[model samples]
Target: MRQKATSLFAVLLLLAAGVAPVGAVVGTGVEASAVQSNCSFPVTATDATGTEVTVEQKPENVVTLGPSEAQTMWEIGGKSQVVGLTKYASYLDGSDSRTNVSGAGRSYVNVEKVVAEDPGIVLAANIVSNETVQKLRDAGLTVYKFEKAKSLEDIYAKTTLVGELTGNCEGASETLSWMKDRISTVRSAVEGSDAPRVFVSQGAGWTAGENTFINRMVELAGGNNVAVEANVSGYGKISEEVIVAQNPEWIVQLGAFGAYPKTDAYNGTDAVKNGRVMTVSNQNVSQPAPRVVYAIVKMAEAFHPDAFAAANATTTASETTTTQPTESTTESAPETTTEGAMEGDSTETTTDAEDSTGGTPGFGVPVALAALAGAAMLARRR
Candidate 1:
């Protein structure tokens, strides 16, 4: 886990800042500590990082340390509270004021830097060091170990917890409720209606299985996951025989591999022959960001093409009939950053994964790099 954490930070800093990888080992140092009394939630709780961090008071300065856990904070309207990140947790506007801490025995943010950030609480992923946490805790910093969110249930719980932790419980509840309602609506719309067989790929050559949140989204979108047909764990390989036999109607490549190479399918397979392949944004669908619900609508549009197209036609008609132009901040077209939208390597949009450009990785190849995204995606499913 430490190695994984270190590698993640190194990749982010290198790609984002254009800094070469530095040889800084993570460290351990318990600094002078003090506890202030301003407590609100519970006296103490475990974080996803498995640390038993306590809060004397509601946290004013927090370092979000999970994959997209910072997003949960943002959803609760508590962006102002985040004071630091493991890496890529800088999406919040006022986050520049937050410190970036690394490790010790290396040039990264050592314990000194963490102490310097002076965070009252550290929002962690499930994979940080207990020793490091103990040091922070011993130094009087409240270290709450956030459990890793795995399924749809986890997302709801995590959102609620983030809201509670950041004094934005109302926002959390509302957001989670809205998400659940929308998902339910989608499910009911397609429930027992002969679920369409669909295939979704994320990362290099991986497909979404029952183990992932995207699989749940697929079900909600009225599409059955082909990967889950095998009932495998995490990301596993699907043989060409399986594809030829099942013959999914839609093929979606999520995350960095948004584009499924339909042309590259085995001798023009059904997914390619049917022209059901489409590329999409990872932030909107894969990452549990603010736009996840929107992903549902768009994905539904993909599944029931005729109905969605008709619905879109009605929307266009309504807009055309009663549209009043407001002052548009985006007066000009956005400058295109990508020349061609490659299936596995294109970083066309300006989301979080803009700077991690490297190799083109896809089916059968190892997930050498996310090529276009720098966002951390560690999950604390426990």
Candidate 2:
């Protein structure tokens, strides 16, 4: 049992270290209206790499260097234009039909495959190295690299910019409008409610701090981030002592791989005792795309259920009276399976189980071993 625990702990650490930099979103300070007009050809804009790239015409074929970029393209109605993408983007629908441009790992780009695609434009993510971007450019390809997205505004700007680049301006506008409306609803719902103290665990001891999208999500969902409170500046490991001292009311795991470390410090927290633990899908929360609004809404519902429910009911009523309700407009609160656990593809909780080894319940030796193997493979891929 001890051996299993040790091995699991090691894997968790590896996940913690590997997870943060992959698809990490930060701000670029670029406005959505940086371009003059929508779908305008020969439009020139400076990318995150400080290079001016001009898209002379609508791209017939596009390539994405990261999952987030691919997600953005798909969201903005440019899916058919995506001719190449990395392996991590396999989760997207019909991605298998596109050529894989992944090199050795998730962040590495296969320049030769990308060149073969003969893409009209390449959308690069923050995770893509500058050297790789230059290599693509050296091969005479037009590449626009996005900086890290820090805030919701940054994400909005990126979406608009993507649409402009891909000649999907109308789609981008629609997506941004939807995102803003959802965000406004969440803010209104959580208004005047008490903000819970939230601790977001990526895995092991790593937590998101200031200048990260995860931290922004917590704040937007009307919860205070304990990592930010502890002065953790970026994605870094936090001491178990701080976690206990902060006493977060809610603990959020990033993905299926995310788990609270097996330690007295984590077990003694209010979140654990009361079972106020929730898991958000990695794709929605980690990627800086329009889908991040889903994570925000999920967190808002978890953190302030009463307020969210009231707000959601009001919105539904208004929609019913204003027009015929459509499937897209209809929304429901997330279903709770346990005291603090919710259920959905984007948000879920680990099923409760009795811990025989005095560790956290539902996270046993066997489970950890399995998670360890999976995380190791994921780490290698990322």
Candidate 3:
């Protein structure tokens, strides 16, 4: 099972590579008929397991097991097609009305409930047990799975894949272009600023390191990840000694504002003494999707106040003094569970990151929505 899961992950990596060979959506024998070559039929995509999955028809009813998948589907104009979603996916705007197939607490799917939905397509994440995916396939359901994206590039790839599956490739392309533009704006805003040494505290002990999108976002926001600099990779605990030795200038917490209040470990740190510790919404700062740019902007504002201040002042002045009008437009979790052993006999478990390799799936639409809300709050403050 583990080996099969690994193969699935490799295929997702290939999908994240942005392109793959096309194949026909085969008749898996549950209830699906043979696919015919048409606009919707004969759609082919590779799953995380390296199996080529072809949809005989464009899915009229879709079930998304990951919040990120739901959000991406919505962003790509496929919301009307979503008929089912995971319980946690309720965080999305329209998901509350969708049928909740997976149960609460655990990240595993309820195979019986899923089959009852009789969905044309089931979108899932790597955190879903391979057994569950196999069972769905056995039942003649088309299941499309993806591993959590680890970077902006991965997010684009995933978005593109969703677009292709939903027959919304144009929407996906436009979304990708919008994300790039937003990122470029942020980069230009923070250009030439000295990058701050930063620590991303997901919880009391968990911190983001290399090979994770959080680390990438921090860099894009003009800050250096202290955890990555410590040679830590993925999600891991950072020792107090390391924290003390490398006193970060900024601390970005995943939870509420008071989550990481002043403590012995932070007493002398620049972030603590200067009161620079910021609590970004976990949904936005954590999720790896288009809305991630909002978090990046928030981070940039926090990390280099001077840059934003200058930019804001310039904008304000230009708006107030010049006779110019501008047009503006705006738009737009997880598939896996992981069980980890904590300190005691009782096992501590975490879902995959919005895409979780550690505590919970950190990437999804709710995270993005929360990030957008955070951006709004920051905007109001300005």
| Number of the predicted model whose TM-score against the real structure is largest | 2
Best by lDDT: 2
Candidate 3 structure lDDT: 0.58
Measured over all alpha carbons after superposition, the RMSD of each candidate to the real structure, in angstroms, is 12.2, 10.8, 12.1
- Deviation in angstroms for 133 in model 2? 2.0
Residues 1-382 of candidate 1 have per-residue lDDT tens digits of 7655554434332222210111111111111111121225654444534344455556787776532556667666677887675434443345557665544322322456666678777764333344555667678666654433334555555565556555665566556655655555555456556677887755334465665566777777888888888674544556666677777787776543344533345335566677777655543443333445666666777787665555555444323121111211111110111111111211211231222222111121223244223224432221
Off by over 4 Å in 1: 1-43, 46-53, 91-97, 102-110, 230-232, 262-267, 284-292, 305-382
For 1-382, candidate 2 gives per-residue lDDT tens digits of: 5544444444432232222222212233346544334577876778756788989999999998766788788887899999998656666778889998876412346799999999999997654566667889999999987765556777788888888888998778767766776787899988989999999876667677876657878899999999999998766778988988999999988665557676899888888899999887766675667777888898999899889988887675333121111112121111110101100011101211111011121122333344466555555564
Worst 10 residues of 1 by lDDT: 331-340
lDDT at 292, model 3? 57
Clashes of each: 19, 4, 23
- Measured against the true structure, the TM-scores of the candidates, in listed sequence, are 0.64, 0.75, 0.69
lDDT of 3 by residue, 28-92 (tens): 22111111212345667767656788877677888887556776787767789898876544555
Worst 10 residues of 3 by lDDT: 338-347
Clashes of 3: 23
